[model samples]
Target: MAGIWAISCKPCELACVRQEVHARDAEAQLVRLASSDNVLSLIEADAGVLAGMLCSTSDLADDEAVSLIERVAKLVTCPLIVMCDRLDPGLIARLFYAGATEVVAGGSSSSCEPVSSKEACAKGALRQATSAGAVAHSKEPAKSASGMDAYAEPARQVHDRTAFHYASSMTTALDEPDGLDEPDELGRSDELEEPDEIDGLDEVASRKAMGGRSTSSEPGAPVICAIAGRGGVGTSSVVGLMAATAARMGLRTAVIDLDLMHGNLPALMGIDDPVDLARLLKDSDSVSETAIEATAMMVSPGLTLWGSLERPELAESMGTAVEQLIFALRDPADVIFIDTSVAWGDAVAAAVAMCDRCLVVGAPGPTQPESAARIAQLAARLGVARTKMVSVLNRCTASSLNEEFALRFEMALSLHSRVRIPDGGSEVSGLLSFGRLEDLARGESRLTSAIQTCTSSLLKELGCAVPEGFGKPSEQDSGGLRIRLPWDKAGEPR
Candidate 1:
């Protein structure tokens, strides 16, 4: 049974279409969108096809619709189909370019012409001729050339393999209600529900069984600082992934976006108003668990995020405040991953100096080797142990290039690179790329396997015992326990 989530204006024709689709496809589960603001939350909650129905042409021109489609295509790795009154060639082309899987036409004037047999025969051709009769009278410019001519066929070939179906029937519209309320800062809605536990793995009990100790008695959580030799080498992405990996393992994990100048962790994690580090740091006495909880945004189970401050001037004042917050969170979280800035600053240096383990991510480029060496020098100067520092080669797949990365690491930083993450390509690249990577980690892939190995290595470095079957579904099934506690809804500690 396919699940279809349809988004339309309130009191629009989508209600009828939803019912008809459910009737036609008995097994299909149809979910309607309540508001445009909850797109990410809805995507995370539901797993299936997304159908955006635009009844009026004006609705197609709405910025919200276009933005919604673009974000869904980029962030949600699912099939996106747009249902409209007529097939506007330019709009269809742009939608495809924006990542829509298919476009369907319906309404009173359903005169959609089938693709020409000759045009269909052409390999990887996407550009179809505009409707000659009706399109001539329309305002849109004529694009008579093959759609495939302008757009690259090979890039879209994978997406074009599937067939499309247009809805020919119309339904009565419903009464229009007041506008939907604005979405929460985190984009959470009351409609969103918690995800199922990972294969019945009792997170707390399993950790207890392994004799994992709480950090409450200590002053700080285990800090894993992911530093990069240069910017745009996928360092932030790696940090975000590591944090997610740990959180999924049921370790209380928090990701602090220390990249004040150009931080995108909030965007990557789909958090709108993540903890304002600058504001939180203003009060010297506000480093308590309550304060942290009030400021931080909960991303998922066991995952919390402290996003960067927009003001770069606050970076100087943040050195002590950041350190204090790190210490404060120790009792609440088991692990804290810091996404440090690209350049070496006082704050970055302070963070590196304070970290229990440092992951230096360097690209396979000209200056990255020297940059790695500089990081090593700084770590050594700050009295960090050599064994605690690990190096990673980001986005290099070729064997020869990996070897060069290894050679560079050892020669420059006196550290042999342990992890080399392959560029997962377009299928895994986007604003919410970390979520996609986390999904990939659930399945069998070289990337997941590598991530597992790296995680194990880091745990060993931290003197934590690796379970017999880490990152796997536990054999123990407790028959699905579901006890509702007062704070269970928010997943916050009492």
Candidate 2:
């Protein structure tokens, strides 16, 4: 008996596909391919016995999925249906470009629907692929113009219920008389041409502009967690400044507001309406790189901000979601900065433990140093080493009391690195309140110089190669008016 082959690394997704196939046609056997190697071997061994193949994008990256489809299409004579978790037009277009006979959504348990509903959608898509015989038996697969149309009608019957049908309108521009050009070895065309009338061209353009997904061979970027010993110590300000500084220095930076409750990064960055991360976390399993890209708001040229929760009450339950978000950001960013709340909740603990360095922000006072000590103890318990913890004395003044607080904070944490930011008075607060961080970062002031110096020191310690002339005075300050402070050396205290 002919069988239907399915490829998915996720067990739940594979199970759904299997159940759906069995429900639709009990006589049709279901074969699950665990990896790409298995897929090619199965096609080579018995391509004729397979009725169709179901490929799920839930487990694979976008580029990986497109490459797999292109390779299988070149050899297999059966129908290929791509199972997507969401309805992303760019991804669907690419799947069809790579020779998918049909594209359907909600094949994984990550969908908003329950498992039963997901299974029903999978059943409809499978039934259409096998019954319609979406592809012709000719040696070369039928061109997109005709092949896509053949399966489109049957797909529409269940369109509202489960599947999405792409007719000639979606692929008319792709059907050149010369036929589809072979994609390069990396599954990219030498010259990528977009259809003039694609539905989601704007989204596709944005994804491309954002550099798509990271295919870097290097390990993921380091994560830096900024936590304050107490409220009003300017931890969020420090994090925002550092992120903005990094982006200005030609690094792709991502800032995550791990504070969750009462996160103010969006406000500080001047984003009036931020993405609702709480809702995205509600379906953590559905969170993908694509989902993250959609949720992230590009604040500047090289800076992306993943806003915090709109509803503060949802903070406690979002620990797992925070972890998922960090994992998803590993690829696309050169470095990640996390602004954590003063409260040591599950979210804060997770960020501290996973960070490469913990920046403890404190202010000059008797009580704040003690609070810094407590923060140090908690960080130690959370697996952060003393050497990896950097201390910052914010709102510093030229007084013995400020020096005393700085000494106490360093001695308590046993930290080798310490930074000090002179009080910017009300001006800095005004800038932050109005979301004018860019102006504050670029302004020629003692506070701006201190923050820029601190940012440079942190980046160097993180092992990132600093660009030429980084942290130098801007053209406006080129009149030899730059002042050097005693704490210019990042790791040493005055």
Q: Highest lDDT: which candidate?
A: 2
Q: Candidate 2 lDDT, tens digit per residue, 1-494?
A: 55565555467776555543443334666777888778888887877667667778887889999898877776664557666776555565566545565554545555422112123222321111111111111122122112221112221110111111112111332244432222221112222233332212221222121111122334445678888778888888889988888877767778998888888999999898998777656453444334455567778777788868878888887764565566456544667899988876666665665565678888766688788888876664333444456788887763544556667777776565677777777888899989998778888787787777778767765555556667764564334234667775675756
Residue-level error in angstroms, candidate 1, position 404: 2.9
Models, CA RMSD each: 27.5, 20.8
User: Which ranges of candidate 2 are over 4 A from the true structure?
Assistant: 1-217, 282-286, 398-401, 472-494
Global lDDT of each model? 0.50, 0.59
Global Cα lDDT for candidate 1: 0.50
State which candidate has the highest TM-score. 2
Find the 10 residues in a row with the least total lDDT in model 2: 155-164
lDDT of 1 by residue, 107-215 (tens): 3354322233122212212222211000111111122111111111111101121111111000110111311111121112222222232111121111111111122
TM-score of 2: 0.52
